[model samples]
Target: MKFPEVVSVEQADQYEQVIDVRSPAEFALDHYPGAINCPVLDNEERIVVGTLYKQVSVFEAKKVGAALVARNIAKHLDEQFSKNPKEWTPLIYCWRGGNRSGAMTHILRQVGWRASQLDGGYKAFRRQVINELEILPGRFQWRVLSGETGSAKSRVLEGLAAAGAQVLDLEALACHKGSVLGILPDQPQPAQKMFETRIWDVLRKLDPARPVFVEAESKKVGQLRVPEHLFEQMTQHSTVFRIQASVAARVDFLIEDYHYFLADTDTLKQQLRHLVTLHGHEVIHHWCQQVDAAQWPELVGDLLVRHYDPAYLKSSNNLFTGFATAHPLPADKLDGPGIARLVDQLLNLQG
Candidate 1:
């Protein structure tokens, strides 16, 4: 049969195909980057085996499992693996680098291909991801850019990236803006596992000899958790750049970014209600009435001063007191060109 040795995490990067032999449900929850699910046992079959493992003897479980495994493998060879040649090397894994992978590896080998199993299965791979996030910081340099909600931090990162500056756009990788309104217009945010994959892919492409620019963010970005290793690196290797704009200019920037406000009043009302407790009932009531009257500028001004601005100022004052450096953009009469100039200036700064 198809007996194989375990492949380490470092070795995983070199593999062409990463096959996950877990049920589709398990694969949906989270899986190794680049892994495609080709379950040797579907969910119901796995549950049956697991129940047998508890109620019956190991020999009994193996007897039932063997039959299910054989049927599934034949189906896989017929439906999926039939296209690939005998020489294709595939890295296969399951939840614990156990029977599922062993079964698949054996089947693949029977077809004359060189295949391997990931050591420890997906769990071991996850451990490596956690360890990399926790321990691998002393080796690289980082630059962090800090600003309030409408400070154009994402745009600055994009500009820096365009100019060949080493840049890590965490929000872009996570597919969310790291805020309530951070959702993109038409695209859905990626699953957390996919987010990690995107981050890892970008990191692999970077030149460690150059400094990387990233935006400041809490560990959680919308629904995704920032990888611990990368977050740890940001905590220390980071040099911060602060961008400043006046209340009016920031309001304009926010309005431009959130076009949903232009089309739906109900959506705007729901978003506004999320801030009611922070702004207090009476003030929020006034804003609500004003909004219904279509007083956009008045509503924005009050919300900025009474809500978003105060919160941002408090956070900026408390956490970024000793920022690496700060720069001010245009105050009155601000526009895209002025913002672009500010971004250019911030990118010019070296850590």
Candidate 2:
């Protein structure tokens, strides 16, 4: 039998299964992409061993921690790996390629399955993600798709992706719609570290030769900020496309898109309250009255003209210099068929 190999984060994907042996809390924060959590020391057990390490002697701590690690590894062998073939190779990692993963690797190798531990473990993986995110955004040819709310920019972006165009959808990654009213009801955004990992995951697979379509998003999406270098690259160099649709089309699209708030006027009123400082209490209160009366068209029209349009114009012009001369692509139809046509138009667009 041979000693287990030591692998690095970059080569982790070549393994049949990448096993994360960190505590659940550590795994939840972030781990290597496609990694499975089979923690050697779970949450409570880790704390117990940590306390003993501090208060008791090193020998005492190792005795307890070793017993715990042994039991967990045995449990994994029986419950998780029982059905695997002898040829199955797995990559394992802990906080810093230390005793936890080393113990698992040694045991698995003893079982005649090829198992390896990651060098520098999760810390090394995170550093890789950080370093890649720093420069990856510049590698792509970016087409900044800009539009006011309800222009169906998000929907069109989805269509573009389905139609075989490379797309970097920031709002989708952030699990938000990217506005004061953008929070998804059932979807929560990932933690910042996990978010960066996901971004890096998508970028590393994309070819730099293709143009990646993305929305004109602000620095922050919901509570998460775009990686600094990414935001900088997006704002500095890109072909900007300004999508135009009639105000009526926008209103109709918004009512359908935000149907959740329409049914829950209390939520709609609360969201409107957030806009009081910008549009003044009187205008906001008037919009609330429209909400209570189920006057969506009137309320939505007022918002687009008063709130969404002006704010988008100001921000887009300020952040993207190309916005002053953005290519205007008009789509009065925002329905399913219209989105399809828009996708065709986007693929055929020239600078």
Candidate 3:
């Protein structure tokens, strides 16, 4: 029996196995979460066919693609379908749910398993992700936290979440801290579709009636773009908590938090270099010397004052002037009890 394409988001979500029929390279660059790569035609074959379609004719391209598709499907039937349990119902997709997924479904059914195709393939799912993100913030309440760099915004989000407040760490969702230095040591960011899907998953599970605390951020984090609709809601629907601290205290906090950067002076130097265009060569050079000498606190202060401070001042002046209230935590001195008190006050303020 020939299966139809175009399942709803709920139906797609319910499928046991989500298979990506695109090539491994295509899958690696970006794909749906939990999707397995089972190419109906490998990367080279796809490229060749595409080139043929452009250079020659659609008829010739289809002729070549058909032969390659049959060959690849046979391989998958022998190697993969034979191993899976009888109950496995795989939902498959290609770039646009064209020939690739159709070919795979044909083979899977021939082997006696129910295989289906996603409507409009991965592209359609991506559209749904965008739509969901667009509508989410309107359906939920937002409590925003704003502060200078190294003010531990992400940490505060985690703490509040632990304390039973709904929270969305947009940076964590993006696999980036939303800064130049945010790239994790070895891990790469997820694809845009996967990022949106992850965000939707989190949003879907949240209590919309409760306020979710989030940090103030721009529309883009690393390579991923936050939906403009959600961002617009973030700007209007949220109340801001300003966490203020003195330069000295903030520098100390930064040093303690980012000690790993101190281990390798070169890493700090490279990051500092990016700031040199704004700060000038001599200023960054002197700071690099301070970093080399293990004057971490001093280095942190200089970098912050030179770079983060001005930006923060401008942003703070413009945004959240109507914040519900400002709860000033001690900058120069912070401990478990003090932080607990601050958090308690913030939560109480919510009530």
Candidate 4:
């Protein structure tokens, strides 16, 4: 059977299915946003093939690799593609629009499905991501929520989203809260390319005419860096909404919001260790002791005053041009009702 014609990454949505025929590790690194991983060569198998290609002849390597690819593709056909009708159309791609994708496209086409390869494969999609990141962020009008740690900016962003305001929750997407202690339990951050793909997905969905409400964030959120162009647009073009809440109120909010820390004192202490260089061993040790003693409020209050607030103030003042004349909205508490009131105020300001 003949192989199908290649399609661009931009045309991915036109197909009913998007299959990534790369190794699992490659897919984990990045692929088309919704592409399903149906690896023709898994990590270990890929290593074996590469080793054979270098040590043995290319002919010998292809012979062994072909068997492995056939077996895996057959398994996918029986297990994953069995339900598809003859009319099922899928877009397929590998690392570089090469043999891995071509094999799958040929097989699926032989089965009477209209399967097409992604031209330039994942590489093309990556190049598109790079181009979009450079230009797409500038297309949106952004409204940024800026505040100290525990000031309920995330909650406010959620409230804005729930209130039907277009919102971009970068921390949520990154699965980290943009802090030393922000690592989510059991959830690892996505690979850098995956992170960029997620951003591109969201950016593409947004209406450029409408303003996107986003939280103020540092360039890096945990282990992943925000795309340079998006970060630039966020810092330079955003109209800042500064949330106002007292230290005590913020502490109360944190105690309620981050109650997971109370249950996992050891983890909290370990995260606190990261701050030792900035706050010094003596201060971190004291904070750890406070955690050990179960003095939640006191520990949170001290961290807010000593560590988070000063750092936030310095960075926000220096980095965000709109910080000086930011619109102030009082957040008496970080509860639903309080956030709802703030959302109303925000919408009214926009109106």
Q: For this target, which candidate reaches the highest lDDT against the unseen true structure? A: 4
lDDT of each: 0.74, 0.89, 0.76, 0.90
Question: Number of clashing residue pairs in every model?
Answer: 2, 0, 1, 0
lDDT of 2 by residue, 63-180 (tens): 9999999999999999999999999999999998999999999999999998999999888888889999988998888899998889999998999999888988888888899998
RMSD in order of candidates: 3.6, 2.2, 3.2, 1.9
lDDT of 4 by residue, 39-147 (tens): 9999999999999999998998899999999999999999999999987889999989999999999998888889999899888889999998899999998999998
Candidate 4, residue 219: the lDDT equals 79
List residue ranges in candidate 3 displaced over 4 A.
1-6, 74-81, 190-194, 246-249, 321-348
Query: If the candidates were sorted by their TM-score against the true structure, best first, what order would they fall in?
Result: 4, 2, 3, 1
Question: 288, model 4: CA deviation in Å?
Answer: 1.1
From the highest lDDT down, the ranking of the candidates is 4, 2, 3, 1
TM-score of 4: 0.97
Q: Write the per-residue lDDT of candidate 3 for residues 57-107, one digit (tens) a residue.
A: 999999999999898878877887778887778888998887889788777
TM-score of each: 0.83, 0.94, 0.85, 0.97
Off by over 4 Å in 1: 1-5, 183-201, 223-237, 261-268, 287-297, 327-343
